[model samples]
Target: TLLEGVEEKIEDITNKLYVVLAALIKGNRANCSNFAQSARLNWLVNRLQSQQASSGALEVLHSVLVDSPEVLNMITEAHILAIIGLLDRNGRDPKVLDVLCSLCVNNGVAVRANQNLICENILQRRDLLLQTALVDHVTW
Candidate 1:
């Protein structure tokens, strides 16, 4: 029932909802633009702050970056920090890095808009970046 769902923690719900939202918006330009313009953009960015939900949030973030051109200009410094955490924070959470890889591999407008900032942060934290790669590459 609706009440039962309400009893579930919002973070738990959003973990799945983010992926569903990402699937819904992937390759859909209008929805992507709407997501960027709406308060949902803030939600997506803030979702990255949640250790429980950041991975699903990353999925939605990757989908939006791949799908929305308008999102590039809309990004903020805080957003950059959140995305940076994907590479070197939260202990290089594999799920987070996997979606971060999508951003790198896709290199859409949002990633390009943020690359200089991202690069600067990466360089400033060289040891962290190397550790992330080592962890990501380790087979066992």
Candidate 2:
């Protein structure tokens, strides 16, 4: 349903959604804690399934983590990883017309291969991506 749109404007609208989400949580301690403890964060985690929404998800997640330190201290079973890296495009990403999260790096290779695997849509990998994709410190 997310991809269903005028096509050209899908990205614009998606970016705007992130702007709204970011504005709602930025520097708000209570909002951040509720987001961390509530099921609302699942929506953002699910958004990561879409390559289109993944960048904004990360940016918004960064804001959440930065605004609330309690989130980290409460990571008993899981944790969040604010990964920093550069996405060196081997070629022009024609499919990706625009990106909300900028990967400003000089290197050509980026690690966190687990993320690539979980997000891949191969015959077997597709099941894993659909069933359970890691969003904790290791993958993100």
Q: What is the TM-score of each candidate against the true structure?
A: 0.68, 0.45
Q: Tell me how far the alpha carbon of residue 41 in candidate 2 is from the true structure, in angstroms, after superposition.
A: 2.6
Candidate 1: where are CA atoms >4 Å away?
1-10, 93-113, 132-140
lDDT of each: 0.69, 0.45
Candidate 2 has a TM-score of 0.45
lDDT of 2 by residue, 1-140 (tens): 55656764877678778878878888888887876763555555445444443456556665665666555333321122212111222122221211211111112323233233323322342342135667757643
Q: Count backbone overlaps in model 2.
A: 0
lDDT tens digits, residue span 1-140, model 1: 98867756776776888778878988898888887774777777776876544667787787786677567567677777787776655666666655455544444324564567767777898776575533446454
- Stretch of 10 with least lDDT, candidate 2: 97-106
Q: Provide the clashing-pair count of each candidate structure.
A: 0, 0
Pick by TM-score: which candidate is best? 1
